[model samples]
Target: MFAGDSDLSLTSIDLFCGAGGLTLGLENAGFLSVMGLDTNRDAMATYRKAFPDAEAVEGSIAGYDFGQWRGVDLVAGGPPCQPFSNGGKRLAAKDNRDMIPEFARAVNTIMPRAFIMENVAGLLAPRNREYMAEILSLFSDRYTILPPRLINAADYGVPQKRMRIVLIGLLKGSIDFPAPTHLPGRYVTSGSVLRRGETQGYSNPSKIVYARRPDLRPSPYAGQLFNGGGRAINLDLPAPTILASAGGNKTHFIDELHAVIPYHKHLWDGGKPRSGELEGGRRITILESAMLQTFPTEMEFAGSRSSQYTQIGNAVPPRLAEVIGASVARALN
Candidate 1:
């Protein structure tokens, strides 16, 4: 499919391509993925199983040669977000895990006709404004850097309200981002996709029940960060951002409802009424997280349950990626 360097048909590679989410979207948008790279073995295993044709490289991006990718039409991937994640330490450039420098090096060395970088919106928050400016300056001389846009996955038909920042750079011209395909009130909900049971060709996911600790108080952020409702999911609305955390603070959905009790009932009742305390509330299964992230049901993912959850949480929702991919593809044309 990627027979030429022509804008309409382009060859691409994905760096930090955990579980192939970004590559999948780019593939759907007509860019042929030449290869994919990541350091995590389990994630690479999942990527290889999913896209056997795309050569998978398992290693760090640092010290890697980019010369082989010289003719690549596009380079796309998000650097790790832990350094700037609000749920994280917010270390910015100080964190040893910050990969933005390597990302810039790849784009600079590959000199692709176009590129797309995605990250948590926290990178653009006021605290990291200087770092954001530094990242943009890296391409100021060559690529026509489009304004960094904070995009909502729900706006593009994903079933969750994930707010991500995207930066698109082109060698010659600019491209407008894809407009929202759905309205706010009409956005898809978590229940709409999660209510169904296991289907053919998909893994059957068991529900996880939340256990309350008497010593701890209910997390006020039981729902999505932007929404302040208790942990029980408002099944009628889009899900909160799927977190990468493996902790007690992660968002949970209410699987079953109990008789209405005081807001702090769970706090004193030793975690009773906690999210997942009843039949309906619990931590989301890996499959459920994938669905919320807009991955296809039939697509197979490999890894332990927790490992798979990490992979899914870190992925760019394919629906959102598809939208961005199409926009990038249009600019190439």
Candidate 2:
């Protein structure tokens, strides 16, 4: 499948490829993932199990060799948003959060045609923006920076509402992030997914339920992310960024309706069932979380429950990754 358009059929190396969400997207975008590197051995296990052919190196990202790790299409799985996120503490650029420079240092050494860095919205906070600008400026000689965009996962087909910042860089020509396909309203509809024991998927338009017929329509998600007159959007475009702790972190959510899905009766244990107290719940299962990130069904997480959560949470949603990879692949021409 990846045999055609060799220049555009780019080879990829994913750094910090936790459970391969970004790699999954690049694979979908028709790139050959030659290798992946990550710190967590467990995430490496998950990544290797699903992609046995791809080489997955497990260890700290600091020492990864840029020369040995060269690829025509470069990508970063994540740079660890911990220092930037306000959830724990806002370290911004100083709190051991300055690894992106090292990441860029390696990128400069390898010098791929294009690359992308995904991060928390907090990276744009005044404290960190200067450093981010510095990194952008450093890359200016080689890459035409695509204006950083704050994208919501719901803007695409994702069932969740999560915001993320993406910086896309190209060697010469400017890269334009794709325009949002679905706008508010304009045929975007919200509906409820039935539990395993429930009757079926339905669009109670009065209740905003989309009905699934046994003969025709197939049910997607069984649980609903809406209540109190809010709803999930079925977008025609690619989904917003699938967050690392997307379902777990409620503070990142915009709509009250979306923030509640993780705790609610999702397709967990095959969709048997959440309480009202689940409002600020712990999190949803790793499987449900990965699904929201657009990983393929054939791939399974190979780790403990929490490891699975950590792996899925720390990933760049594959759907968004596809856009990034395809953009680079096109640029290679």
Candidate 3:
């Protein structure tokens, strides 16, 4: 893992901040976040529960003062991943995807020194590319553009191999790809990391390796954080990304390994062992999923078992937030 950028003292405002992944990454980087805005009630509840000190506003950002956000050093979020994913029905600027543009309006109003936008790699799809282009194009008229970089949580030490596009907007300079803190784990087959060292790609699009969209799910990631190559971060990496499915819900069905184990149901009921997994072809439990997302060890839920799961899944990985915060701090210093 990367040496923590501990001295950066920037602050941030998170938008469309479902579960707070961007918020968490920025916090990890050393930025002090003042607020997070999202429409989902449970998602906000979970964010507030974990980050009691920060203001987790539950609502659309459309009616707020984009101008009042000026003092912050950064504005960040992943928005909704589903609207642009190939696995789901693709929706670009038309399918409620216009929120991306709305997000831009927020950034324009607040005007941080730097802003970051992240979404599923499918956002890079030919048609959706224009929407991304439009957002950046409008911003570029006044700010330095970082273009857009695609990265995976796995490459950065998180066990799951989720890949997304990150757009960095600077007030006066450019943004390069963040340095690699970790590489692919040995256990996660080469197919998952990059097409067998092909690095770039050949004429046949599928033959292309590194450029291919990253697929989530690391091979057999049920155990603790162990990057055989010796990375320093935990299983969820610096901080885990919150899932849209997270927060106050864990109606899971476990695999026979967890189901037929003949062990007490209480143990796996809400522990860290089950995340993104299906037991007996059913969803995993609540508690385990939260731990996988790396919620603070002290965090607790006041509602039912599923309520607890919902909160965890909806929270921003505190670790990732720190990373973003650190970068902002660097610029401020």
Query: Predictions ranked by TM-score, top down?
Result: 1, 2, 3
Candidate 3, residue 276: CA error in Å? 21
The stretch of ten residues in a row with the least summed lDDT in candidate 2 is: 196-205
TM-score for each candidate, following the candidate numbering: 0.84, 0.71, 0.67
Task: Report every candidate's CA lDDT.
Answer: 0.76, 0.59, 0.54
Clashes within 3 Å, all models in order: 7, 15, 53
Query: Residue 131 in candidate 1 has what lDDT?
Result: 88
Q: TM-score of model 3 relative to the true fold? A: 0.67
Compared with the true structure, what per-residue lDDT tens digits does model 3 show for residues 118-176? Answer: 77788888878777777676663677767677776555554444567777778876555
The CA lDDT at 44 in model 1 is 97
* 102-199: candidate 2 lDDT, tens digit per residue: 66876787777777888777877778777777768766376777877887655654444457888887776665686664455532222221122222
| Candidate 2 overall lDDT versus native | 0.59
